[model samples]
Target: MLGPKIREIREQLGLSQKQLAGEDMTRSYISLIEKGRAVPSQRMLKIIAKRLNTPMEYFLGESTATDTDIGEAVLDKAKLYYKERNDRACIRMAHNVLTLTKDVLDQTEAYLLIMRSYNRLGEYRQALDNGEAAAFIVTRTGDRERIVQYYLEMGRAAFHSELFHAARKFYEQAYTYSSRLKYLQDEHIRALIYLGTTHLRLGNVDQGLEFYLKAEKEARMAGQPELYGEITLGLGKAYYMSEQDGHMQLSYDWTKKSVDSYKLARSESYVLALHNLAVIQLHMGQKKEALPLLGECAGIYDERNLPHKKASILEEISKIYLEERELQQAETVIKEALQLLELRDEGVLRAKLYRLLGLVFHEKDNSDEGYYFLRMSHDLLKRIHAEREADISHQILQLSKQKQKMEYDDYKSYIR
Candidate 1:
């Protein structure tokens, strides 16, 4: 069935058996394949299809392949790569599937896989683009679950990129979509979690805490410890950041529970919980207490091959050392963090790293390097988050003992 179609397209393209076979594949094998006397392996079929300028799915006799056919085979392999955190391979395979499948469902799945692979690779803009494509396909499908999932994934990508308003919009849509379904406990809880996170980022801390608490209740009722753990962590963060001092202990307790609950089940959540615990400690000026928490978070990020998380944890550790006036230790962690932030070109974190490095060098009596870094941080602050420029500018001026007037473009000549 497939051989005739392959031969038809091959001939239409004016390609002979030997031309299609290439050096590694014999012409006899190609002849056998075209004669329907032998079958091509999936790999060989892919090569043949590419050479013939047709979707392999076409020759496979499915007008469009489902998410379980040859397209699914690629998806499955991509998923395996994702599980192993081999983002490059996952991304490559996801794109391959995108080109090979015509089924709407299969295409949506491929776009989603590509989105997540880009997310893992820290390509948030590309992640959003692919997520939007997936979302567009499902817009008329009425699969509320998939709609919620699409929004949730996009919201997460935006959140990771520090696009808080965009994240909120996507998460709000996720909640709206999930709410249309009557009894999907998991979807409801997940949507609530993302919505609450967006709320927190938007500075609606009280509202975010309420959603998190509600979600936590539902999670417990549904017997989902992972969801419950995440909710508990959210609650901890809300409380820890609130103006009320009495909530600190509650935050600490809840954060610890989240860490313990997720420690064995969810590696990502476990590391996040640890980071939260460290934040709580740091907020209370207990830098020493935060060290072990940040240390564990760092180790987990490394084990998981998460450069962003690792850089963040390392930055937090450096902050603790800075608090303790441990200049050498602070410098060490800040340098390590810069390497990681630079790898992904994390502008937001890079700005903070520059400021920290600047402070460390200032304390080390290296005025020239200190001034340079602080000025860079100030410039970044002005460009990225202008609201924070006032405080950062003050730091820059204080660091400049000679008070040399460094414009925003001062560091451009040397650094860029």
Candidate 2:
């Protein structure tokens, strides 16, 4: 009965023996267990029970056959909803099934899947909330790998929210777990890169550069060019943020290296590298060189149906137009960018777009519009307490006031 049940549940869950095998179990061991040639240990039984969405009692042959039929029905509906990308529905169904069977471990994994779906949908705050809940449950059960993965997902959510410090903390926790386990080398490298990038965002250039370089070397030694590309992009961002003349050149060089590595790996990192290089060129007063790269980035993002990346490229194009003193062109590009913002609900990115729009209007001598958008940006920045963004807002307010006062004085002189 246990052997047939194991095989039945495995097939229903669409999981192969290879997928169910972990550190302590091999595919052959799983096959042996399912064939009734070997009885599983208590822990292994629990693992299989969680994977199959069935209670351990089912395998113990204590449950009535009717229970298996009902459990399979619930699992089938959950699988269908998950396949349809209806994550919330899938989570609800999975939770209800777990309630019926007391399958805490399976419920925890289901919640993680829901959290990932939220992340994919650009619901970072909700994703973080769900991930924290899942992490707590998994950690209490002593599921080390799941705990590590939960922390990594939480870090990604924090990073998206612009909580650089919080993101770094979570990534560090993930790194500790991965290091102690010594088996998840890919995850370890990813944690290192994420931590380094967060440090760069927090203005710790030297430390960030050090971490990025270390990650790059480790990735290369591991023969993982994708990881190498990711770390190089971090290094390039660090150099770009240094805002020093020589560092700008270094930024371009690193960005080029990142692009080359990503291309070799046949990854999406190439698009990101192109965007970063364009930003560097725009800052370096090479608008002509930046525009073509921005166009390429925009096209790639659009092709991939990534509205966030497209919005970012549009904002960069607005900056180039503003720098060139083509105010009308800047305004047009900003409007297009704002349209992209409607597709997703990311407050930080929206705030940034508003700030860029404000700058564009201010350069166009439209003080009223400029001040309005600037104030909107400031309000959003204040909510996040983004100090660097707040500083930029403050500068914009000061300039707006100065420009207004100058216009008033000129009007008075004309009346005299």
Candidate 3:
């Protein structure tokens, strides 16, 4: 740690250990300082500080608990907050780290932590700013591994910000670098996955599945079953969206593999697999099985305190109930979902909620209330640029003109 502090500061300034050791000290002696095997005398320390253009506090941190130790502890706490999904607390602690040390490496780490915190908090623009700042000074001269990490961070920021093309570009750049470095296989796999997922979001399902398959193979070779399970989840999703005649069966198989794998690991991702599995079962006309899975998924979300996700499951449950002529049950669950959504007010999801409530009221033959909620949902969908949803609303509106008549085909299309 002793020599490493000096080396870190030198590296931030784009100086090699040999260059920092020249004229006064031997390179091997400097290596001993970096390796924590030796400490420099006061005079030697002063000379080294002068050459490195750093304050004596940089070296003092190596000897005392003033900065390095305390700053590292703070960073550890920030990571803990991140893991606990406390974005505000993580952001506060990461900012505290910057105040403790002006070291480029430490500051870079803090910036990145703040970036992730902002992203989790739905502050995409702020997250992207911090992400770009994390890499601005070091992209060309910093450690290759660290530079690749920043690329991944920036790619995620772009993805969350809905800049899918930029996200793909950043992931591709990172994948290119990781390809050249055999030791960066982990990052290589991650970059590939992100690139693939980005393309998937952009509706390039084949390309996305290709990358996911590659990632799965690499993860298996690397003995990382968790990573393989993750890729299988994506593969299932991609196949589900594929328009090919036989892809639905492939989707079921891949989704089953991910569900089984995650259940063995006791992982939260299994809940997502369960949701997908239930959706597939509904497609196969097995609503009897799907309802229980959706109910179980909703209970899990409730226990996790994720009201938005619970609302989603509740909405699904209501649609099935409506199709089964369970009008009162549909009204009950849709109202529950609406109340949950009111707490968080995710507008896109809320639009769907409004639509579901409208349909439930229509199914109950309450034309006035049905028309009102349907119109509300249509306005919201148009505002959100959800043209497909707006079109669906248009259909319901036209049906309202026919005295709220919902034909069999209308019922088939009512499951938003």
Candidate 4:
């Protein structure tokens, strides 16, 4: 009878066992109580009541109830299905609870869990649909903190889909909610970081930098070194993308700081910091200095199974060879990079590789082949609307034309 009442109240509020647990207990433990196989401890009962916005006595059938006395066996089965990540089964069980009780919270929690499963499976639209429904229900119930988290989830989905503006909008809404709640310090920081990254993606560099700096200051004040390291990394990247030699050096300095902080914390954040530092060093004509850093980055990416990042580092190695006038070695390295790009199916990276190959051919005095590769790179970059690459491609085209004219003039002079 207690189990049935618990399930009834859970359904009436539309909360899933997992949601009711609220980071206090696992979904499996919640199921045992619902099945009458185990009675909830006093502490557990209080948590569930708080999560369901009900009284603990409600589970004991003390208050006026609006649900049937269904057996606890069905609840046990539902818990089992949930433990297996079977969203369909959970939804079915939630429907049964709904039939016996008009619990909006239970329904909302079931929908949210289903949405999360869909999100994990990459069904972005469906996930957004279900998440939006859950958010609507939560909003109506005035669960401000949960509503903010739901919006953040939606923002993450939008960010994954490359909808930067939409992601920013959602993140802003989440931030507003967090501010109103005033108790979610960590959540506010997370929202700020996402907002900063979104601005960076949208080419609003100054705005991005402002947000990152603000986050860094807040993190420092809060004694959160890890968050400080993260924001510092973002600041370094923003500087690197500025493309000025001075700013590139500044980028290297900031990244070095980030790497040191991360190392102190024994975190994996050093991987990206090292990679970015290598890039800046390469651009500064310190190929020898950059090599060891690139090697470290490659090893980390390899361990993480990030083949595309590994290939990118290989491409940088080829660039160094090209700059050093080692045409044969450059050609070999570029060929390896081409193979990697093919395997990874990375169009943007392949375009970069092609441009580097153009430089290699130009160095070998094969103007025609060099121009052809550069043109190919330019076309691909144009298709992607990569403004920085497009500008570089234009410069390459101008240089190629000048080189061709010089070669023709030399040929005429020799014949004369």
lDDT of 2 by residue, 252-306 (tens): 8989888998999999778999899888887777877988998999899889988
TM-score per candidate: 0.65, 0.73, 0.68, 0.64
State how far residue 15 of model 1 sits from its true place (Å): 57
Choose 2 or 4, whichever is better by lDDT.
2
How far residue 243's Cα lies from its native spot in candidate 1, in Å, is 2.6
> How many collisions per candidate?
0, 0, 3, 13
**Better TM-score candidate (3, 4):** 3
Best by lDDT: 3
Candidate 4 Cα outliers beyond 4 Å, as residue runs: 1-142, 243-246, 331-335, 338-351, 361-387, 394-416
Tens digits of per-residue lDDT for model 1, 1-416: 87788788888889988898864355776877778866664556777888888887788774433544878788889889988989889888988887776554556666777787887676888998877666656553334555677788898898877777788788888887666345555877887887787776555778788888888877776666677788888988878756676998899999998988787466567778889888778867777788887878778778877787788887777876776678799899989988887666666678778877876776677778887888888787555443333354545546366544333233212221
Task: Tell me model 1's lDDT, rounded to 2 decimals.
Answer: 0.73
In candidate 3, stretches whose alpha carbon ends up further than 4 angstroms from where it belongs are: 1-90, 96-102, 119-126, 138-141, 155-177, 199-204, 344-348, 358-406, 411-416
Arranged by lDDT with the best first, the candidates are 3, 2, 1, 4
Model 2 ranges with Cα > 4 A deviation: 1-93, 100-104, 161-166, 200-210, 399-416
lDDT of 3 by residue, 288-379 (tens): 88889998998898888888788878877877777778878988988888789776656556777788777777767787888899899989
